[model samples]
Target: MIRRLTALAAAGVLGLSGASATASAAGGPPLFTDGHGLTVVSRPAWVDGNERTFVFTVRTAQVPAYSVMEGQVSGEHTIMVTLPEGYDRVATRYPVQYHLHGHPDRPNTVVNQRMFEETTVGVPLITVAPNGSGRGWYTNWRYPPAALGPQNWENFHLDQVIPFVDANLRTIARRDGRAVSGHSMGGFGAFHYAEHRPDLFAYVGSFSGGLDLLSQEQRAAVIASTQLPGSGTPTVPVESVFGPPIWPLDGGWNRESPAQHVGPLRGMGVAMYTGNGGDLTVDPLQAVVENRAWATNIVTRDHLVAAGIPHTFVDYGDGSGWAEGCTGKHAQPSCLIADMDHFVDLLMGTLTHP
Candidate 1:
């Protein structure tokens, strides 16, 4: 039978374990909670058998409320966590791996945790996967202010979610204690977070991610993501998150692309994976997507080399990831699992995962 715990943060009260020092022993106080005003209102509910869950509150509500007086639930976000096996049985702190999901997605316990937990079986680490918003782009919106509700995903993840996790959980609570990884768009998010705040993470990995946000093809691809198939409806209303994807304003694009900012990743462990025109699972077009990702990653890999930042780059060509029952090489499970297997190994080598 499944067990349920009492609501820790009951009735809007911040119910965190004030005595985690006892549980974590040598592990220091929570890093992101003291100063950060985040509240944990409930206990975790893992939809999947492996991963646990946590629903916390953010100070600023990025998305507006549907009904004015009702308030916004987006302010109260969900971050599903996968604790080390025997977490309840042991009293120790562990390193955290923040896994980001792709576009048109939410923080899913099953979809995200399955690959991570399966690959890291017996490994002592925590996997925290937060709701990054469908088509959130994982960046602050740069244009179309009126139509889209306040879109500030970067601030939500960096300023709020990261700290909140550090606050409530028995984490290592430092740069060396944390790592970030993502698939497809989340892949972009992982690198973006690592590149922007190199101090917060010790390792970064991207599986079939869009590292070059400045590429014209990538820019157009994002535009296409906003619309639905067949119906042509505006699914996500992503106007322009990277500032006009064209000339004039487009010049500003280089300011943030992970490929252009390799210096920040100097000492950090970096790993990336993608298929080279591999299995076009759904259709031939899927191959095009992987092909595009491969192109962007090559330039990014070269940038890392130029900056003397050592990284593992795998362009597992055609018939690589798909043969394992996955749809194909682009943004399916097989590729992400492969990425995690290699990345977790790299992370274990650097992080204090005992």
Candidate 2:
């Protein structure tokens, strides 16, 4: 079942006011109760030939609560929602597919929408891509040491984003009608959410995901790269997300790592894709990172198999590439699109309409 944080628990963590607490207890819409607000920042505009896009700025109620404790200020976040062609003419509700982006990458709704539109063709679905606020890792923070500003991404996505999409659009609104997928860090988030909140999604896909966070060597490499002097915005400290790398035994790491939570994914439709980091089209540094991620994905896949969880494993290794001219390298647009196409096909074949 989708394990929702109880209103009481959520209110306590967010420090909701008396009135807000009551509203939460009364089970009001998740975002409406705590002054967590949603504003349409942009009008529904036509984009990428036939799709319609709407952008909403989400002011999180939970972040302010965290800020009060940490004495830091938090800001509103934005998400883009895309509707399929003929959406205005159709009276039918559609399945919702949430596509999550990697760290240092903002939501790419237009590219995702175009990919979906071109690949799926007649498949009607609403595509939602929410910003991960850089390096939140889509996990709830193990507070005090971790910055409270971005660490509450799990709440923002589950309690805020999902509810907002359901309220504003025509959606399937249930587990079978919903799917989640992402790339790199987002791939980890997709599996994390599926394992943690299995009741919220029937299918989950991860593309070039960092599935195993407990590896010491990989952790060290990630930390080194992220802390490079001239890196751009959203440069994150590894300690802020998962604490010290003495992970594996660390509760924080175990809680978020998909490899640690494979039991929950039993019976769920899971799809994972990883490139072998051998493509000449990608940067050599990125190729090395992709190979590391591929190793992590392999370990995660093995765990799932050991747990008897059946899944689709797309290993676009160094030699075996896609027929569509994409190879096994991290962050290849063509490879990601091809993986998404297969994911959508799986969703179409497996999910039953309510």
lDDT of 2 at 91: 46
Worst 10 residues of 1 by lDDT: 63-72
What lDDT score belongs to each candidate, Candidate 1 first? 0.68, 0.66
Residue 280 in model 2: shift from native, Å?
Answer: 7.3
Candidate 2's TM-score: 0.79
* Residue 137 C-alpha lDDT in model 1: 69
Best by lDDT: 1
Tell me the TM-score of model 1. Answer: 0.81
If scored against the real structure, what TM-score would every candidate get? 0.81, 0.79
The C-alpha local distance difference test score for the whole of candidate 2 amounts to 0.66
Residue clash pairs of candidate 1: none
